[model samples]
Target: MINVIIVPAFQDNYLWLFHRQGSDAAYAVDPGEAAPIEQALRKHRLQLAGILITHHHADHIGGVNALLQQRDIPVYGPLSSKIPAVSRPLADGDLLTLDGGEISFRVLAVPGHTLEHIAYFNPDEHLLFCGDTLFAAGCGRMFEGNPVQMQNSLQKLADLPADTTVYCAHEYTLANLKFALQVEQNNPALLARQQEAQRLRAANQPTVPSRLSLELATNPFLRVTQRAVIEAASAYNGRPVDSPAEVFAALRRWKDNF
Candidate 1:
């Protein structure tokens, strides 16, 4: 089994450190800053084997050069010139094997937040490390890609096994759930998830690594096809939406203002 350690950084960003059990070498997903990553590595007594970058955002790749200066390590990231640190630029449907092949991930091209954004999915472990793409209940802002790309990307993730654990890069569950409630106030799963997430946050806990099933059940972004969600989107759009992508576009616009 692969173990994961959460390294919180810069307000809400989470740098995921993962390794196989009994392994001294570990990998970091989206290390925004080097100090927190270095501290976590020392505390866990694990050497940084490699770095995984999901996109070219500053907060995701800011510390890559610094970490590489300490020790040369392979930097795996999207196949784009936006991030020059990527020594192993991966493409869609590519398999990434690391840590002497003990850890392997399928590169999924999930371009919504950025044109080159990708997610690493370990099918055997049922784990997903998606940086600034799919959050606990919310997804990243469509800074580059359009609603169609974002919705399609999220669908690819939603189609994953229900047991998959989502390791998103931010802690935005409560806020996302609040907006979700506005769109689907009568949803039982959304209410339950909001209560649980509130309890976790009140106690100063990180509400992440949520199950794919829970996201599918409660995340408004993933529920564009649902009647309630489409109704809400149409209400906000001032017109009826005919397709799931249209509903998604309207919902994304509403959430952008919410």
Candidate 2:
């Protein structure tokens, strides 16, 4: 089994460390800072095998150079002109095998939050390391991409197995759920999830790796086709839902201000 450790960094960013049991080889997803990661490696007595870059965001790849100086670990990432030093440029449908274990992952070009954003999926492990694309109860802001692209990206992730464990890069669940509640206050699933998140936060615990099923039930972005979300977006934007794309656009606009 893969043991995952979440190293909190730079306010809300999470650098995920993945390693198999009875092995010293380790892999990190989005090491925004090198100091903490280096310390963690020493503390755990593990060797860095590779680095996975989700995007060119400084908050995601700021520590690549520092980490590389410590060890010549291979770096894999999406094809971005802005990214200077990716050893392996990955594309959609590419498979990455790590360790001697039967571990394999597929690359998904999920753009929207960023034009070159990508997500890594390990079907055998039912794990997804989606940088900023899909968040618990929310989605990323359309910074470099449009609502249509983001919607398509989200749809692709939503089609994953219900039990797929989603590992997002930030701790935005509480804020995202607050917005979701405003949109779907009557949704019992969302309400219960909010309460659970509150409890976890009260105890100083991390609310992450949320299941895909929960997101499908409560996330407003994922429910764009539902009547409640469509009506809410239309009413909020003062526009009629001519199609799902319009609803998505309006929802994205509302969330931008929200």
Candidate of highest lDDT = 1
Instruction: Please state the error at residue 11 of candidate 1 in Å.
Output: 0.7
Estimate every model's Cα lDDT from 0 to 1.
Answer: 0.93, 0.89
Q: Write out the backbone clash pairs for model 2.
A: none
Candidate 1 backbone clash number: 0
Candidate 1 C-alpha lDDT tens digits along 1-258: 899999999998899999899998999999989999999999999999999999999999998988999798999999888899999999999999999988899999998899999999998989999898899988899999988899999999999999999999998889999999999999999999999999999999999989999999999989988999989889999999958789888888888898
Candidate 2 similarity to native, TM-score: 0.97
Which 10 consecutive positions of candidate 2 have the poorest summed lDDT? 239-248
Predicted candidate 2 versus true structure: per-residue lDDT over 1-258, tens digit per residue: 888888889888888888887888999898989988888998999899999998989988998888999687789999888777689999988998888755778999998999999999998878999999999888888889987788899999999999999999999999999999878879999999999999998997889979999999999988988988888988998868746667778888887788
TM-score of model number 1: 0.99
> Which segments of model 1 are wrong by more than 4 Å?
none
